[model samples]
Target: MVTKSDTNSVQVEIVPSRFLMPETAQRLLCEIYKNGGIRRIMIHGPNMPREVPYGPGKGIPIEANRNLLVEIGDQAIELRVKVGRIRLEMESEDYLGGLKAACERALPFSFQFRQGKFFHDRMTTSDYAKYGKVEDERILGLIDPKAKKDKLAILSEDMVTFKEDEER
Candidate 1:
């Protein structure tokens, strides 16, 4: 996990007026990262599955056209949802102006930015049982502190994958 002091971190919530397309989201993410000072970013929206979950085609792979290939710096990331709200954590409050400017430039639709704590701030029962009491409050949230990385994801070129018949 990416360990850093979140005590002074500032959360900026971006809610778009409408569901964002894959290309739009990718563009916006790139813009935000380019502006710098971002510690973590969480994209939230309606779940989009790779396969049909129920009915006669329950086991079949979904032919979705909205999947995105987002590039952050040199890393390629896959975005699986029709982005609705984006929550970002910055190192400090000083980066707010740049972030807001980036958002305005990248997002064509109207958006709202609010500052507050959107992520978990304390350890839960599951965290204590799995990792025990941790001194760092930054590692106390829903994400696994010992995990490989905290917020970023490296994705392959192909954005979609099909499930085997038996696995479904």
Candidate 2:
């Protein structure tokens, strides 16, 4: 439910030829965020569960191989997807060229970038129920803007560690 500060944002959709590995996605995210002008980034992909859902291994806690620790500027973000499609909300169309170049540099495989609105810009029913009808559109579509804590982890640079024994 991430939104941009500016209403005139263009969504830069980057779809890879194949599902990206965690390392590749991490590298690409770091590169994109470092360039700035990117207001929000939404990654879309198949869900990866933290535990085995069925069979002999049902209910067993397991490491999701696709989960990655990506360093974006000073922020250490945990990517929860295998990274099928990345939708970036940019402040202006002026950053398109630089964004393209950055993507090209980070992604070795084939990918595509397009400019369009990929998400709902207005408030939804669930949003209203969760946070009420707030005047700020930035917090409109979000679930809980006033919450003291966020569900996502914001790790420090030194905490960018991964379990090597985890199955891939």
Q: Which candidate number maximizes lDDT? A: 1
Off by over 4 Å in 2: 1-7, 64-67, 134-136, 139-168
Clash count, candidate 1: 0
Measured with C-alpha atoms, the lDDT of residue 159 in candidate 2 is 30
Worst 10 residues of 2 by lDDT: 159-168
Candidate 1 lDDT: 0.68
Looking at model 1, which ten-residue stretch has the lowest summed lDDT?
Answer: 159-168
Candidate 2 accuracy as lDDT: 0.64
How many residue pairs clash (N, CA or C atoms closer than 3 angstroms) in each of the candidate models, in the order given? 0, 0
Q: 76-159, model 1: which lDDT tens digit per residue? A: 555666789888778888999999999899998789999987868777786677667766454333244333333323222222
Best by the TM-score measure: 1
Evaluated at residue 89, the lDDT of candidate 1 is 76
Candidate 1 clashes between residue pairs 3 or more apart in a chain or in different chains:
none
Tens digits of per-residue lDDT, candidate 2, 58-78, equal: 988766543467655665556
The per-model lDDT (C-alpha) reads 0.68, 0.64
> What's the true lDDT of residue 124 in model 2?
72
